[model samples]
Target: MKRFKHLLPVLLLLMSLTAAIISCKKGGDDPTPTPTPAQPVTTITSISPATAPVGSTIAIGGTNFGTSPTSNTVTIGGVVATIVSVTDTQIVVVVPTGAANGPVSVTAGGQTAQSQSTFTVYVAPLKPVVEISGTTFANQNWTRDKIYLLKGLVYIPADFTLTIEAGTVIKGAAPDQDPDKKNMAGTLIIERRAKIIAQGTASQPIVFTSAKAAGQRAYGDWGGLVLIGKAAMNTTSTAALPGGVRGTVERYAEFNDNSGTLRYVRIEYAGAAQPTGSATRLSGLSLYGVGNSTVIDHVQVSYSGSDSFAWFGGTANLKNLVAYRSFDDDWSADWGYVGNVQFGVAVRDPDVADQSGSNGLELENYDPTATTDVTPVVLANGLQQTAPVFANLSSFGFGTTPTTNKSAKGTGAYLAGLYLRRNAAVAVYNSLLYGYPEGVSLGATGATPGVTNNTIDLQGIVLANVLTPVVGNGVLTSDLTTTYFTTSGRANQIVQSSDLTALRLNNFNATTPGFLPQSGSSLLTGAVTGGKLANSFFTPTTFRGAFGTDDWTTGWTNFFPQNTDYDR
Candidate 1:
């Protein structure tokens, strides 16, 4: 009985303690407290770009998308988007391509309002913009007669007119075929009568050269002007040519007929030679059968190999030409050429000569046996001479006398600046000649019959030289320069003023002599008038020098510095 009573008292004490604890729990005074409402899921954090570029992934942020995520999906304007990542408060989804550019609303729930915000996608550009990586043309394929330009070079098919803006710079490409043939160069082959108005002013001259040029690049590093004309090609009745069998003729009718005008153009550092000798070498501007309707004026050829300007057989009329520092002949005429050129100047390096190295002009009848009568060419006020200096044989090794030091087949034979051979007839008058082995040679091999009746009349011609003075042959005598060269040995030098008045009909005052009548000048007031010339052709009276007066002192000078030691 005593033990039972003791146990009952103990149970009563424990019950009292339990009852106190239960009261405390009922009064909300428990030790373990509830978390404060989890900060009410209010003020949602920021979403990483509710708007972004197409194909971009965007982040969505909010209070509890769902602790367990019963359903998780994102949509932009009701369009289902891919969910790249998901978190308790954020979801990342990818914007699809072709997605409309507009304010996009992102939603996560159906019933409950999800965190919605406006987003946008950027639109892509349409045109292809050129960058440092190179030119990126937008519409490469143009409709019929449409003109397209990528980079600076204009690519046109047949029967298309490519209108180029004035002062546009067209860079030639590096040689694509036979790199070792020295055929590594680029070219512009204008087909038929496709007009190309590439005319630039003296202030803004159009430049056609290599990308390596700081101001100017090395000469002959690339091919030059290539104009394919519809005037005439090799004879159809020639039996000597491979394709010109007597019965099978390659007529001129097959050439493309695209006529164009190349006025006030300057071609520099062109005419790279191939392994097939200079015959295959590309000229600065190769006008192949260009029509006589085309106009070529105020063109300058600087630092080139082969001929600066070569006319295969085109009736294009050319005037005001300047050929400076050309490795080969400055001007060359071949095949069926019927053009009249006036006020042409040829300046050659003193180190070179005529026989295989020097000649101011070269006229040739390509198909000697062909009966297809080729047209005649007229040249007036054309100057082909330069001052004499020590023969820098090494500089002319590859161009002037490649065969002198090296074997004939080993290197190559250098041609002259001017070589009139192959039974071709040409007329020249009132010009200047300087240091050259032969100022002008009539025949090439044997007694050529072309020069017998041909007229090469000269009135006031000047031949100047430092080392070996000019020695004129044929009807042209060394006494032509007596009026200009006042110096003892230079008494025969022609005056610039005389050349101006005698060549063209421009009023060049004694004060503003242009390139003529300058004090102590080689060419003073002396020239053949238009009526006096065999062909009554008139041109501007800017003294016949390689450079214009402004080019030397003022204007945007494209001075090609002579520092070849450094790799361009």
Candidate 2:
């Protein structure tokens, strides 16, 4: 009975030890870690830079991207991208050349992920180097997006039209180093019967500038824009007109010839002089016999080497013309020009001038020769009259005092406010000529008989702060003042007075200038109120100057051409 009891106690102890071992196994050591839920299949959330061109790097954002780049394969637009970097939540890859618009897919491990949105691929336009030199027979259209690099002398022949789209930019390269060619400057010429339909808006205006970098651009960087038409121009050349005759040519056009339009256009850093020619110098915008039907409004010519705007025997009227820092004349008319100009403003640089003679308005009836006589009665081309009417012209020069002549008079630069010579029959009205060495000079080669009869007819002209208000080189000064200035209709001639406080010109001599008259200025209401320019072609405004209640040159004008990036 003692042996049986001992065995039962031993059995009980063994059973208790077995229960303790079972409890320890149930509470210790993890059970296979649950496999981490398979990481949710590594979903893709989005892609950065939804649209990109070829060769651009795009980023893919998602969850659970593999750490190794080789493990993750990203394809954009069905083309495999070169994976640059990879992380757990993002991947950056370069777009391949053959990429198109499609959903970007990423494949890692045994799973594949696709972006919810499709990526866009933009095809860049091919920038072709258009070398336009010869004549164009058919219509030529220059689009806005394409970049045109102008080569040598590009001319539009007769009966053709060159249509430049709005916001189009035309750049001229540097002059070629051709020794044989006198002037290898690039020039765009529109021959008679040819037209340029460059109609730009206030927001998207056409730009003509140098191809050089902005800070490297300068005056005379390239040749200017030239438009030649079949309009009446009284030139001394009896030989047959090279382009065409106005009355007898095959496609003879009159003053109302529609030579297309040039609106809201900016011509910068132009006016390169030809090496050898009768017209050696070129202006920013040269109109050779451009008829009245041609539209030229809101045109800004800045940093011109020669005249800003010159009309060589054309009746095309201009308005809202801004001539900024021209090296030579601001507005010039020659070859029997009879066009009417209104609302023209010219701001001159104190140090810039030409040795030949620079003036605010240089009117010559005909080409001057040593043998030509200065007779006003003599008609130009023996048929036409050299009468060009100018109204509401605000010519601002660089002079502090009445006799402050900063420019070199005889050697470097000759200064004049209004140079009426060469039998020029110019009528100035409602004009302001301020700060000039010589205000108004008549007769370049000394006055002859009947000089004052047809030379100048001044009315409502303000010659303020001028060294010499009215003077004649060879004619009697008394006779000039009596015949031209002291007429019954002539009035309001201001000279050397401090009363010019009304003209609120901002930085008149600086690179950036503003010519808008301030409030309470006399220029706002001093204009003729009878609608002086109420013709069909002109829009009548009560204000006298180019800028009035509305600043037309606000949006498109670029005052600082030196800093602009033409390529951008």
Best prediction by TM-score: 2
lDDT of 1 by residue, 1-568 (tens): 9989879989999999999989888988547767877334422356577557666787767755543333665566456677777777776778875565444443334423334455566553433222111222221222212112122223333555545455555555455432233334555555443456676566655556554535457666666666665555444434221110012223454223446667666777776654433356677777766765676777777777667777766556676676666766677777556566665655455443323454566676655443422333322111111100100010111212122222332122334323455545554434555434333444422232333323222233443221223332233333431211234422224323224334322222211223333344434334434433434344433333332233331232233423211111
Worst 10 residues of 2 by lDDT: 242-251
**CA-lDDT, candidates in order:** 0.47, 0.73
Q: Best by lDDT, which number? A: 2
lDDT by residue (tens digit), candidate 2, 1-568: 8999979989999999999999989988856656555455777898888988777788899987888998998888888999998998999999887888999999987789998899998666655545565456788999787667666567788899999999888986555722335445666778788999999988888998887786899888877788887666766434333212122222233777767899999998887766644555568888887888888888999998888998877678888888888888999888667778877888877677777778999887655652344444332233354667788788888647633433542234646788876656677667788878777777644434234454556666777777777766544454565466646456656644667676654556465566777887666665543333455645555555566667666877877788765564
- In model 2, the runs with Cα more than 4 Å from the true position are 1-129, 177-182, 237-253, 367-382, 402-411, 444-455, 476-479, 486-488, 509-511, 529-542
Model 1 is weakest, by summed lDDT over 10 consecutive residues, at: 386-395
* Residue 307 C-alpha lDDT in model 1: 70
- Which residues of candidate 1, in runs, are more than 4 Å off? 1-155, 176-184, 213-216, 234-250, 253-258, 274-278, 351-355, 368-418, 444-452, 455-459, 466-517, 520-522, 530-537, 540-557, 561-568
Please state the error at residue 247 of candidate 1 in Å.
20
Give one clash count per candidate, in the order shown: 50, 0
In angstroms, the error of model 2 at 451 is 8.2
TM-score of each: 0.52, 0.70
Q: Tell me the deviation in Å of residue 87 in model 2.
A: 40
